[model samples]
Target: MTGDEGPSYTVDDALVALGFGKFQILVLVYAGVGWVSEAMEMMLLSFVGPAVQALWNLSPHEESFITSAVFAGMLIGAYSWGVVSDRHGRRKGFLITATVTSIAGFLSAFAPNYILLIALRSVVGIGLGGGPVLSSWFLEFVPAPNRGTWMVIFSAFWTLGTIFEASLAWIVMPNLGWRWLLALSSLPTSFLLLFYKLTPESPRYLCLKGKTADAIEVLEKIARVNGRELPSGNLVSDHEIELQQIDNPSEDARLLSPRTNEIKHPLGMDSNLGGISSLSVLLSPKLARSTVLLWAVFFGNAFSYYGLVLLTTELNGHSKCVSHKLQTEKSQDVSYKSVFIASFAEIPGLLLSAVAVDKLGRKLSMSTMFFICCIFLLPLVFHLSEGLTTGLLFLARICITATFTIVYIYAPEMYPTSVRTTGVGIASSVGRIGGMICPLVAVGLVHGCHQTAAVLLFEIIVLLSGICVMFLPIETMGQELRDSVQV
Candidate 1:
């Protein structure tokens, strides 16, 4: 028997029994670096675009392209990295993909022309694709009881990262220039790589890959790191054995679920799917309905959130205080300071999500945020006092941003471990399409004097998204995970 036919249960049981531990905390801390790095770069454009535009004398269309270029590359990266990490290992994605992204982010600082900057930012985006899975990797290792809470807390880093970028830009952008800001954006890559260097691959991943011995070894490390001893018994899992079956190599040699661990042709002949599709599993009778709804939720979440958040640079201009920052003899960094305050709204939103997710269940809490986000956006369809309008914007930011963490933490919980990342990747790519759409459409509309239409559209789409959440069939709140489950 090959590793596939070895002991059915190995590391998962040990991890579950170990409970929540410090090792999981360590993973969250490391994963936050990638979150910060990518968050900084994604938001970097709002700061950099003005500088690039001033430098190159770019038109509105040209400036929009700069943002689109990154999402275009992100579309490919998010999907591919998820699949690759599932096929190879999450550690490789953290190391190889993030390093490549950091370098691209850093190199954009030196681009000679707008064309080169766009190309470099695209490269930065492709690398950024691998960054989101840091949450999935963390969730896979942590105990199930508190997984939702931790993942929500983890998303706070996205908020913190944005705060860092804004605060740093406020300090340095006036003197050091946008080039320096871009350079600093890439710095987290090296730190993220170093952090993962001391980390182990997910033990659940090792078992699925049939690396029973390796999986156990990692669990021993987890137990030790968590300040506990491995239970004195077979680490093999009874639950996994009940959930998994040996597939006939000739009939279905590859796993089509994003979990992709269903069957292994470790020697390579039957390893990759030849005829089946990973997405096909998500569309199966058992999952098809939920998958469609899930996609809608993901699409709506991404569309409404990024669509609005990205336009902050332009939107902030309409505020009296922000307008003063731009028009007055105020400190040059005042604009940056305003940006920091707007993005800082995400902090309290995440904290609220962390507690609400457990207290209200993922469904109620997430859907509520989605609808609440819509309510906040409604007043923006018409004129209001500048302060009120900005406050409304910040309020919307809190709701949509909270929705992001909630959906992200919830999606993987719905899937078996085998396909969790794949599910997330696909959903995220769909979301990126939203991210791609909003900037192209909304930015131009804001420029063309159709700001009301833009606000209405964002509100309508998100309202539908919240409705989708209400229809979701599964609720993972306070649920234990399934490390493996049969077809």
Candidate 2:
């Protein structure tokens, strides 16, 4: 700890100047594990879907119910946990989600019936729903200069999850069966709780809660770990300054006036200029339009992304569809191999987005990739050869996965710290509506309706999503995150 004799700086200045170091690296490891686990639960249904169908002698509709259950939980979890973290603290939210998800995941494997399985999956989904919080939590600690790149790269961890799921299915789908696969997929989540102990609560979060002394202590720990000295004197933060300014304005002066529609407080209680409430802040004038558009992007992204992911094996062959043991096993083998290969596409996709987001700006990166995804999906619309269709589907997956990464990167950058997690949670919860609908549409449009309808829907949705990206007004390339939502 160096002497507290240097320049008097706000916490933001101290943090930005310290730059990226051990703290960022630790976040990747700690949060990265959570990311991988969340990815696994999201992908688990896709991997286990076919197996569940065969074991329980079920219809595609029931299969969809199981897949969507987790997303339903996630929708609720994202909203509830976002509020928990904002009002209580980030650390509490983090630990609670990890613990609940882990226990639910492990126990879900033992469910005896299809109804029980989906029910348990819903619990797992709720825990997974809190996943967006990890990104916002980690983002506050990172420097803005490389923040977009780091976010894209962080999303790349999803590839490892894809690898884990496909590889697990390849090995166990034959001998161990779907029950064992579910068990194996969830077993690793216990490690996330252990990792939780290693992460410090976000200093920004502490500052927001008015625990200034605790916030400074965490910052010093981060500085020490980074081999840097703290800039001295009473370390201040923008939040503290805002509180002071709002809490103590001059007599007969209302510097932080409420908007036209807001209620005026007697005895000066409007100091909570957090704009009505946490959720209301995003709906405030400066942020409302961006919030709606961003939610549109999230909805389109999940609708297509998970629609493809949860049905990858099913779309490939009748292995999980047919009842003949020998044929079902053989077809499943082929589907698993194909899923493994296509998953490799995600690695390159993440790398491309990591570089593209930095070079192309967010809107262009998302728009270009989404357009390409629609182009690739056109082959499926034409009902091409299996060989040609499979190849195109992989290409489409790469593009959509890349687009997904950019959306996550773009959302956090769009909202400020005051409502970062809230904005993300609301957007994600809306996206999960698409996720919930994905299974029903993916299966119904194919088996119940026609494959052509499903392909056209996917193509149309991806194209529309790309168009939405192009319409966004701002492009957060290397902009710093502020304490207030500034549109």
Candidate 3:
């Protein structure tokens, strides 16, 4: 009577039949809106840090605190929300993050003191920390063959978000002030709230949790939206699909094997495990090694990527004495322009990733980009001319952006649906440690007359990250998502 008692069809079957259509398009738009909102919140720090420094007459150390506070909150949110999504449902996390980010970010603009502003920004970060879940949520809907490309494309919204924020800062900071920039940055997230009601919980998550009727209902809605019909069967879990494959014997079975180096399920995890138990799965024998390498790569990527973004303001502003226009321009104008131009470098990087992830494979694509990033940073060790320095930073930004996007696309594919969000969340939390440390080296150390040391530090860390990526256990180029940990 509940529509749950019947023979079942695999969720992947229904997804493939659904293909890409209006349902997915709406998912992309709403998810991209969330991506854009998080990017604006992150980029807000670089702009806000300087404005507040001048306004409050704070030192570099105090200014760095403004930037670090957000990362600290993100570190907590990433792991906590990851557990929450995996245990409760992905949809719950989406609604809560969007609501929290919008409210806190908008209120930060009205802070009476620097302390209050930092507190509000931290709360905003707690919400922004859930950003990685958007990728996990989006990927569940994509067909396997196109997942890499679509995920990379999904990440492109991040580039759009950064550029949009930079442009807004360039225009608003001069005329209105940082408060207006803060207030305006919070507006895009409102879009997520508007359209969220129309969105469904990830069907993959639903099926794995044994909510077959709910899963079928969601798929039925998707089928209707895409102008197609379901494949005429009940909804089933991934484990059931694997057992049926064992009896049937096909390419699907081969892909499910460990020998194929396809999707490696996190060993010894249960469907009911939540929070700390979910995290422990990452340390199981099968996933333990990959988890460590992923954490290192995440840390290095965050440190280098965020450090370079923050460095744009410092590096370009440092050149004011050398360039004719720079010498006459307002500090804010030069800062925003440098951030704007630097952000555009991410476009080609994202384009290359979209193509390379499917062609060259995840490991090679990520390793290549990381090495290239290190190469671009090597020139900055010694002070160069304004034009050359800006050019070098642009190229470096391209590679780092690509690596960051590819890594996010790659990580979720490594784990099963049961803990995919948790695995990514833990890795991202580790990455937040790097983000928190970036301001110190990028601004604090660089400002303290150790620019060469700062540059060299990033160069070494990035090179090691390239090596680390090559050791990831499996390549998830076109693999179907694993639903559970099975022998």
Task: Provide the overall lDDT of each model, using Cα atoms, as 2-decimal numbers.
Answer: 0.74, 0.77, 0.85
* Each candidate: RMSD: 5.7, 4.9, 3.8
Top TM-score prediction, candidate number: 3
lDDT computed for candidate 1: 0.74
Q: How do these models rank on TM-score, best leading?
A: 3, 2, 1
lDDT of 1 at 337: 59
* Candidate 1 lDDT tens digits, 57-86: 777678788888888888778778777766
Compared with the true structure, what per-residue lDDT tens digits does model 3 show for residues 281-377? 7787768899999999999999999998999888766543332333424666767888999899999989989889899999999999999888889
Clashes of 1: 4
CA lDDT, candidate 1, residue 191: 92
lDDT of 1 at 356: 93
Question: Cα miss at 167, model 3 (Å)?
Answer: 0.5
Mark the regions of model 3 whose C-alpha exceeds 4 Å error after superposition. Answer: 1-8, 242-271, 319-330
Per-candidate TM-scores read 0.88, 0.89, 0.93
Ranking 2 against 3 by lDDT, winner: 3
